[model samples]
Target: MATSNSRSCLKYLLHLAHDNLDFRLPEITALLALRGKPFHPCENFREKAPFWCLNDLSEEDVHSIMTRSICAKSAFELWGHGQTHSELKASLLNYPPENMSPFTHKDSTYRINVYTFNKTLEFADRIKRIDALEYLSFEGTVSLKSPQHIFCLLEDYGTDPNNIPEQPNYIYFGRWIADGQRELIRSHSVKNRHFIGNTSMDAGLSFIMANHAKVKENDIVFDPFVGTGSLLVACSHFGAYVCGTDIDYNTIHGKGRSSRKNQTWRGPDENIRANLRQYGTEKMYLDVMVSDASKPVWREAALFDAIITDPPYGIRESTRRTGSNKDITRPPEESHIPVSQAYHLSDIFADLLNFSAHHLVMGGRLVYWLPIYRPEYCDEMVPHHPCLRLISNCEQTLSSHTSRRLITMEKIRGPEEVDRLAHLADLRFSPYQGHNAFREKYFSGLNKREGEDV
Candidate 1:
């Protein structure tokens, strides 16, 4: 029965969704460390899996843990835990946090959780603020770690109160909790960013911040592939000084019908004007540019506190390298560009890791979306980089064209400090490649032909 602070211990069962389970351990560890408390990775790993025991923890603590856990690296989404085992489920419901207190529930602490069950979250009500006694259906209930308190603390440290919302329900709980329902419960900085864009928000980015990047006032956040400036918007909502860049200006600035489209051509100045107005950014222009991510010359050394990005898929619209004098309109005769022919995306990702390591302080993190075709390609690119460690890869469903891979890397003692780097590169890439059921289905239809033959 360990205690975190004034509060005692509480047990939470986090059933992580497949590969995302990898982030659970690191996410919890990061949050605890930020709160002036640190938990051992090996011991805390249990709390991320089948059942996690967070002794003397608050709702904000849990929320941050879930945020980062879902974010990859240090964050992730909650699948149902313990309950997967019927016997465990029966005992867990009775062990809700409300029933116990810091004094009485020392060892057998109460746990609160909101999980994705059959697509929808089971305890969306209990996620934000936890009072062991309040049922999920009630109103005005707050998790012991109130976000308002966290906001106040940020304010005392010179954060903008305008960044903090009036309502609690506006916060995020992934897509499991519907928007309207979330508005009814709590208001969150992450939710504001998710609703601004036309497409579904990048869950990987949301997951990582929820875990690793602690939102202090004026904390600088950057994303090289600032697609619609989603990460910046999210960080700004959370009181961070956000900077982002992209090769395309039209996607950021074009207004009206054209602004709504992606590949249309536009200029950097126009994009900057539209973005500044759209996100209500005033006085200072966003530290954005149309620069290439592979080149580290754009900004000074050790400038950003955090880095997050989603690189382009080679399968889509061709991203021709600049300084070219080739044909103006028709497609290039060659399908593949030589490594020297163009800035290889694999190299961009590896470079992103290296550059972030140089800019980020120790314990800083970088979240990037890696498309998995040949895992070996990614492994080879970042193989022995001392500046970062590949923490986790959360499998996601992006578009029809690309296979989503949410990769989280941390700055651990630089590349020179890395003792060893290994990963379970084994992925069921084809979705149903080696399953027995798939094999049986394909063979069964062909094997049973005319009924009489042997």
Candidate 2:
């Protein structure tokens, strides 16, 4: 019975998890964009707040976002909200009854849940709070076990735990819509995965990277530094056709010693293809191979829709590429032996960006992590390319002195758009020179901390 005017003005509420605060906006925005919707926040929106009010989104849009979101815990169809309980009541009264009657009808069963952020309430107080909502005309029977409709009264007690307030800083009333895919974190955890390397990405972060890249069904996704194909697994779950390349032969063949405790050698079936089968996404697996990221293996055409990967930080893994010392004599072709030299962090990022620039289709995205030394970190330190535009850079701190940033870039123009000579002439287009010393700075900080402890 809702009027067209009222339905058009309806707003949705998102209750986001506090962890990974920096990645929330980008994740939600990308999800909304997937549905051809723009991120339109209501007035006085706070990015850091646990609750977010979004306007101009349909119920279908909300459902779509919930199906994919890992940062958002749950979403709701907001009925009312205000700075105080009394104000909340006033706001609820102003909501159109025609829009509310279907769920609150006489035959329907419903339940009211009280959720408080940053504070815990006594059982008695929680009961009192729910009982106070009697002002709304809910003709439905109270069914806690299985309700047709669920309403929630959420209270925000500010983020500071030390200075808890007597009353909530804000209150919201909404009908619960759907919960996010946070359960994927536990279900796909690397600890439980069949094939994992020392630096296998966390399942939660791998999914987040796929989301940031806007990986969608049937899209071809690739990872150049695919170690154990963690990123590929996340993309395959989203219905993408995934493939990747790595320089290590043992890793590509899954013939190395096992990383798990009490295990010696890897099982014969312990491989990237088997990982996709474990998650029932084997159909989406294209292939993986042993190839250096610095070398061009693919044809000179844009082949990938998205590139999501976690490059080595040179901590647990060594950054090496196929190379030989300039002074070393070359062996005969028949008796040639493969040799590897150090791959500088700066050059790694440069090759990654350049590779993505040529191989990613126009509008395709590349999402990867860049290690940073906190003391010398700057925006300029992020590698850039003319054909690709920087989208988002989110920081995930590892320790007091070291952190890695998740960098997302979208290819806006094809390689033909820029002159080859000019692109190389620009110093900014090169890899950040400072990154070459990151390994030194990282260890220096660790040594300084050790000295302090003594």
Candidate 3:
């Protein structure tokens, strides 16, 4: 029998959700990085595959990841895996008995669960599959209701639902460790939230943004274009002190017409602070104010641990900033009353990146969404800053011709480290200038689609 001390040599398997295929790897990598561990995949690793075998991670590391991951469904300590049943049996036979004995001991209670990916199996077939594992030594009593340990036999039928293989492409057996925080999506759903807006982020994606920002206990998070504080609510749940700034006074105060159906006006307590109170994280609320993100109000210093925001793309909401026309002259004293001007999409991103570079602490992150016109989108279209390093770009398609990329960047150096203006000389930054016309192009696409239909 393999001793418990040898467990560190075992490989772990992460059963990731099939959805959010593009975001899974970055989410997992960020979670692993939170623990100061690098992502180490085993041989034949597939990024889009449902199951991933990770090496050089301990049981504790797996537990930490599962506690925060929304991409992964479950994780397990891999005992053995193979391409076929015969190969699986041979692999299991080769597994050290010393390690298996602790769980399969005479006085232990255990249960085996059968799981198939992209395919369903009948109860009889599931039983037959479990029965095939008889080759392994098991002295434990079978406990269906309550077991001291749970084991799983997972079969991967490949990713394509239209082309599922007749037999599993691979098989794996392992002891279940922990399940991921996928349930947070349902439990924190915006449908039941106290405060919401037309642009309020979905609960699952909000949590994913927080994770990508590496938000943890005692960290400070800020959202510049916080519509209804949806991002703040997610960060507060993770023990981060949350604050935000919105240009709309009505939104910051939550005193305008209600976004809810059948409601004409917002109630007295319909606000971001109340939203935090609803989630039992009111203590993490710092404050929310009506401030222009284009002209940051924070002092000249590293202020926040992370800045996670969703700037308006002029789709559901019109993107505007507090300003008058450059040629217009302001009258005395009346200048206090702010006027509005269209905030071009290109300038929005440029300002956001520049603001994050100044306000975020060293090694802190900035995670935000960048709307894209699929036909004109390219890697260079992403905005860059000298102090920040681009981390990941994951796309979420909104339509046949439109999508949004979640861009994550980390501040590697301070403003003094490099000439911030140097990048402006490069033509790469000019690619995003096309984004200034995004709104016009967006409506044009809709009109073109309508024409095609006619």
C-alpha local distance difference test of each model: 0.44, 0.90, 0.91
lDDT by residue (tens digit), candidate 3, 373-396: 999999999988888999999999
Give me the displacement of residue 48 in model 2, in angstroms: 0.8
Worst 10 residues of 3 by lDDT: 328-337
Kindly report the root-mean-square deviation of model 3 from the true structure over all alpha carbons. 1.8
Ten contiguous residues minimizing lDDT sum, candidate 1:
149-158
lDDT-based ranking: 3, 2, 1
Off by over 4 Å in 1: 1-28, 39-51, 56-60, 63-216, 255-285, 325-341, 374-384, 397-402, 413-454
lDDT of 1 by residue, 241-302 (tens): 77777665445443323333453534444443354455565323357766656555655566
Ranking by TM-score: 3, 2, 1
Q: Find the candidate with the highest lDDT and give its number.
A: 3
lDDT of 1: 0.44
Model 2 scores what on Cα lDDT? 0.90
